[model samples]
Every structure is written in structure tokens, then in C-alpha cells.
Target: MKRSMVLVAVLVVLLGIYWLMQSNRPMTDPDRPFVQIDTAQVTSLRIESSTDTVELARRGDQWFLTKPLEFPTAARMTDQALGRLGEMRKLTLVTDRPDRFREFQVDDSTGVKVSVTDRKKTHTFYLGKTSPTAGTSYARLDGSKEVWEIAGNMTPAFKRPVRDWRDKTISEADREGFIKFTFVYPKETISATLVDSVWKVEAGAEKFDADKNQISRVTGLLSRMSGVDFADTLAADAFDAPECHLIAELALGETLDLRLIPKGEDGSQYFLRKAGAPTDYVIYKSTAEVLMRKAADLRPKPEKSAEAPPQKPRG
Candidate 1:
């Protein structure tokens, strides 16, 4: 009886201590969303890594990348970042210890700091590497020591080079109903006009029917072309001695002119600049080949004459 009573007393004391400890701990809701922000209200964004920082601002409905370069932001890129933020849910608290932050890549030296601002308020957080759990990431709220396992891999959306955020479109013109097109090369010029849906071509003193397929390809590309990369070092003045020029006179009284500058020894790439534009865009040689078609290339190929039937009499 004495032994049983002693054992029961000890068990009661241990249970009491465990209950006290649990009561003293701060409560965390595992089901809570990682961030609570209205993405539609977001007016600006700042993404900072160890080596670079990118800042973007939204004016009305348009988003512009302000830092590193001043250009329009790619809508899909911005949408992805914002969409991930809105989708994140806190899975569990990884650690509350500051010393473990670096190990989880949530420290200031390693993590990507993402700040989103509305017209009045701003919320910031640090996004770390992907967590051990598939489709999850490690992140820490600004000014908090707690690191959490979030429900999405945020690295791809938030950690990108400046170029990926920029708009890659170089031209977005209407392909059909162009009044005229002039291709000016270093040694010759090829001009064409659309009359009753037929293309009439003039190469120097000669005039011929433009190959429909070939001319269509050129117009299609010129109507909607995107840059493979940006030539940040080159500007409008870099095309003073252009390798070729393409001028399009649209039916709506709009004119779009492009200057092509050759690059590299093997002619694998070319730098293209829009007339009066500040930046130069890099295009592949394949694109250049289409845009810089020679005068002879515009004419239809001569039909081959049918060979005379084999001479049976001689045989």
C-alpha cells in the first residue's frame, strides 16, 4: 500500500509540470496563411537578394520595373510572384531559434527579402530555400524569429534576375493592310507595295511579283516579334551604320522603322533597334535573315522548263 501511494504521488506531480509547461507556451495556429494581403491592392514590390535588388511599381493597372532598369514588367512574371504569395499557407513552425536561421536559409545574408506595398501599407518577408517537404518552402516573417514551412516553392517566383522580369516584346504591329514596305541594305534597296491583296516588288530598276510565301513570312515576323535578349550596352545611336533597315507604312497612317546592326564574326546574332527607341534588342540570325531579305530573294523563282522526252529515235 505504501509503495503504491508513493508511485501515484510522483505520477501526479510529473503530469502537473507537463500541463504547466504546455500552458506557458505561446499558441501558434498551424492552419494560418503565411501572409494576409490583397494582391489586387498591391502597388509596388521590392525583391532583394545578396547581390542584386529589383524594384517595381504599379501605376493604375500597368506595372513597371523601376530599379536596375526602367521598363515595363512582364505581366506573367509579376503575376506568378503575387500569386504564390497569396497561395502560401503555413504548414508548421520549423524553428524559433535565431541560430538556426542561416541553416534554413532564412537569414538576412542568404534569403530573398520580398516586400509588397499597397497604397498605404507594406508587408515584408524573407523567402528561404525549399523545405524537406515536397512542394514547400522555408520562410520567415520580417521582425520575427520564427521560421515556418510554407506551402509553396517561392524561390522561382521571387528569386529571378532582372531580365526575366522585363517585357521581351519588340514589336506588335498589324500584319495585314500594310501600304508599303522598304528594305534598305548596304548596297541595294527592295521596295514592295500591296495592291488588291497582291504584293508588287521593285528591286532597283526591275519590278516583279513578290513571292507570297516569302513576303508573308517577313510581314508576319515584323508584325509580332519578341526579343531573345536585350542589348543593354547598345542604344539608338549604335545603329548609325546599320547593316539594313526595314520600314513599314501601315494603312492606319502609322509607320514602324527598324534598324538592324550586325554582331559577331559568324553572324549568328544581330542587334535591332526601333527608330527613336532608347534600347537595342538582340535577335537571332534566323530572324535577321528574314528581316534583311535581299532584293533578289523577294522575286518569285523561275519555273523550270520540262525536259524533252527521251529521244527514242536515237536509241
Candidate 2:
């Protein structure tokens, strides 16, 4: 072969090898694993910081907070964390020096450790400070020295306190096919019944129009009623002599009974209790008013005619 041709061939081979090395580099690999454990198979998880530790376990499909407090953890948040962990990809390697772990916030004394266990396998990693852009976070596998920036800021999910992790739902019930609804006020009691999916006043002081819109508004409110937080510390008897009561008896063999006790002389808030509920919950004054409406309040107001003002007859 010619000397110039041989030199050109050697240069081409060198460039090809360099490209291959760059392609296989960790930062460039697209399929890098962040947590290494399959989210669907994760049976339990533990998150530990210098001062606190949060433990969780999965039963069937629900995630429960077992440590720091034993309660059902919000499944939505837990699932979101698992999803982010599985989806995170390597961005860049930050450090490998043991002495620099403190600076990166991955040291045992400062860093937060998250571990997930499957049936027999387990995966654990430590998370550090997020990048300036807040788009990626620094992470390192347990027992490994290398620290790499991983996609997503992972702190939001695992660093939350027990209250933030718990399920805040107060109740879950369908409003359709409600057979009976009763409003018991201090002065009077109003009862309504549904026959063949139609609602009418069963008993009251006087006759009523059985306004559908008012009924619907109340139904919608009840359907979406959820507690802002749990007040399990409050005693159930505190609501025994409620100022008002709203009872919804459904055709589905379900009954929802809510009693509202005025919180203060102003009645701007209340300690709400549901029959058979383990704890009482707090609700805003406006919310209590909506739920504890009197029969008169449910009547739709009449609309005035939009006819033009009377004009003089060609005077």
C-alpha cells in the first residue's frame, strides 16, 4: 500500500475507537438505572436522615407508613416517588472522592438514605443537593464511591414528614341513588325521600318544591367533601349534641351521617364528626353552612322578569 494511504487508514481507525468510548460513557448512556429495583415489586421502603427516619410497607396495592407513625401513607405520593426513581437517568458524574462526600451532601452523617426491598432483592442509594437548575439531583449507590447527577429532584417525595405522607381522605361514598336525606336543626327537622330516582320532601313544616338544583349542589358538595386534615385526637362525644345534623341514606345500603358542632360563638368553623368515624375532623365555617343547610335554604330563589320598563302610551 502507498505510505499516505496507510497513514489515512490508521487515523480513521483511531477516530472510530474514540467515538465508541464516548458513546459508552455513563453520562451519554440513555438506559442507565437510577434505583435498580422494579417499582411494581418494591414491597417496602425506608428513608433515613440524621434526625428522623420514615418507614413504609406495602399491603396488596396500598402503601402504609409503618414507622414515625403507623398509618396509611398517601399512595399517590408513594407511587410518584417510585415512578420518578425508576425514570431518573444519569446526567453527569459529580464526584468519586470519599473526602468530598460532605460537600456533595452524600456523607452518612448528612445525606439521606433511601432503600427499597423487593421479595428477596434490595436497592439503596443516597441523595445529595439538587443542581442549581433544580432539574436534577446528585445521587450515589450504597457502598459505591461514584456520585452521579440523576434526573429529577428526588427530595420532594422522600423528605416529607409523616403528616404529608399520610392519606388525608375523610370519606369515599357515592351520592347516586340516595333514598333519604334529613336535615335536623335545633328548631326543626326536615326529611326528604327519593322514589324511583326522584327526590321530594317527605316531611317538613310546610310543602316544598323539592328544588333539583339546590339538591344537586348539596350532593356535589358531599361527593367532593374531604377533610383538610385528621383530628383523631378529638373525642367523638364532643359532637354528640351537634347544633345540626345531615344524614344521607343511600339505596346502596350505605348511610352517611355527619354531625357538626360549632367551634366557637362565631360559628366560623366546627369540629365535624361522622358516624362510625374513628376521629373528628375540622371544617371551615362556610363548608359547614353548605352541608347543614335548612330546608328553606335549599329552595331556589325566583327570578324576576326581564321585560322592559313600562313606557307612556304615546302621551
Candidate 3:
């Protein structure tokens, strides 16, 4: 009986060792990518879909779209895209049936293809349909037959239109250090400068008091302004600049020339344009109203009469 028990113990020990070895084996497979690539070396990225193809390349410190129009692309958005792809890992092997590429939207003709090139080599993959979870996408490495669910969304990042890819920043200067402004109107031109944190009015319209509150208010407006979108097809002869044209010359050597043009006779809507822009942006009249005042509007309102003018009582 003792001999029989000893044999059973040896058999159990052998089974435990076999299980441990299988469990300790690496999860990564030679045929698959268990992790993503480093993005520091990525010099160019090309995204292709059935409808369009967009390309972004690094030039020194900035990233630019090379095709559809060579322009500066949004920096943060570009970096976020590359970072998300770098974090991709094969979540699951989704090939359960044969000829199932179309069902996953990962077929060669239907998928969104992303190609990244570094100084050394290029890596390419196809982005299929997004997963139901909304955080992941179906992907297949170039030349690989298997499809995977990677942990990122690469569709919207690379599929923007030309105007959408252009630098949409109307102003990028720090608001605190702005020191000067030059506003030009039909009747008058006002130039205001900052000295020792106090605003000094250099020139203004006739009878204009250079009201401190109003001048400061105009200066404050610059901080809140930004470009809403590109006016790609603004008509050349569509502006009427009789109201006000403002030029804010900042300490950073940046100048913005904004003009207000009411749309129609009723003046319900307005159109605005800068000096050198090929297009004009449509804005509401209220947005440009502060800059469209005559000298009377900038003066302090009249208070109650201290000593009434009593001579003209009978007339």
C-alpha cells in the first residue's frame, strides 16, 4: 500500500510541473504584434481611405500636411493620433470564419490604411470598423492575413478635409504682454499704447475723450477673440467698411486688421475681413459693435445738470 501511494504522488508532481511550464510561456507570438511601435522615430504618416488620402510629415519642429494643400497641421491633434496608435495592442484574434474581411470592414478596398515611416523603415496597417465599445478599432497589419482589434481610433484623425487640417488659430499670442493697438475708422484713427500697466491714448477721433473704461474694454476684447473657421470662398467685393476697421498691433510683432461690414440694409448680420486675407468671415453685428462707435459713443455719458441753464425758458 505504501508503494502504491508513492507512485501516485510522483504522478501528481509531474502533472503540476507540466501545467506550470505551459502557463509561464510568453503571451506574445512570433506571428503577431503584442505591442505597438515607438513614435519618436516616425517621420511621416500617410492615411488612405476609399474617399481620400491625407499625409502629414515632420519638418524640423512642426508637422505639416503634405498633400491636398501644404499647410501647418494642428500639432496637439497630430501628436495625439500617433500616441494612440503607439499604444495599440492586439486585443483579440477576430478571424473565426473564412472570407470575413468585409464583415469586419477590414478588406483591402474598404479599410482605412495608415502608413508610418521612420528614419529606418516604414510600418503600415489598415484600420477597420470601430468596435462597439467606441474605444477600439479593427485593424490588420499590412501583408498579414489576420485581423485584430487595436486599442485606438485612427479614422477621424487622418480623415479631415483640407480646410480642417489648416492651422485654424486666429491668434496665438499671450494676452498679458500686449502693449499697443491702432484702430482706424472712416472718420478717425485711434492709437493706444500701454505704459507701466496703465493704458495711454496716443490718438483718437476729434472730441473723443479717450475714455479709460472704453479703451480698456476694447483692449480686453482682443484676449477673447479667436478664429472660428476659414472663409474659403468669401466674395472679394462683399464688405462695406464705413463703420470701423480695427488694427491691434501686439508686442509680439503680430497685427490684426479687422473690419466690420453689415450684411444688408437692416444690419441684422455682419461680414468681417482682415487686411491681407483673401476671404472674409461672416460674423454677427454685435461682435463688431464695440469697435464701430463714433467719438460721441466713447465719451462719458452726461450727468444731471449741476447748475441748470435757465436763460432760454420762454422760447
Q: State TM-scores per candidate.
A: 0.83, 0.82, 0.69
What TM-score, to 2 decimals, does candidate 3 have? 0.69
Residue range 8-123, candidate 3, lDDT tens digits? 99999999999987664334343445335668878898888888788889998889988866777777678877776666677678884438787777766888888888888888
lDDT by residue (tens digit), candidate 2, 1-315: 699999999999999999987665435355777656678888998998887799999999889989977888877889887887677687777889999888878878878898889887888888888887676778888998998888778877787776777886665657565677899877788877776666677445575656777777677777768666667777646866788888988777888899988776887777788888655777888878777767677665788879998898895
Whole-model Cα lDDT per candidate? 0.86, 0.78, 0.69
Query: Candidate 2 at residue 159, lDDT?
Result: 78
Sorted on TM-score, best first, the list reads 1, 2, 3
Worst lDDT window (10 residues) for model 1?
A: 22-31
Q: Residue 186 of model 2: what lDDT? A: 77
Candidate 1 lDDT over residue span 245-296, tens digit each? 8998999998889899878888899999887665779899999899887767
For model 2, the local distance difference test gives 0.78
- Model 1: lDDT equals 0.86
Ranking by lDDT: 1, 2, 3
Point out where model 3 deviates above 4 Å. 1-36, 96-98, 201-225, 235-243, 252-254, 260-315
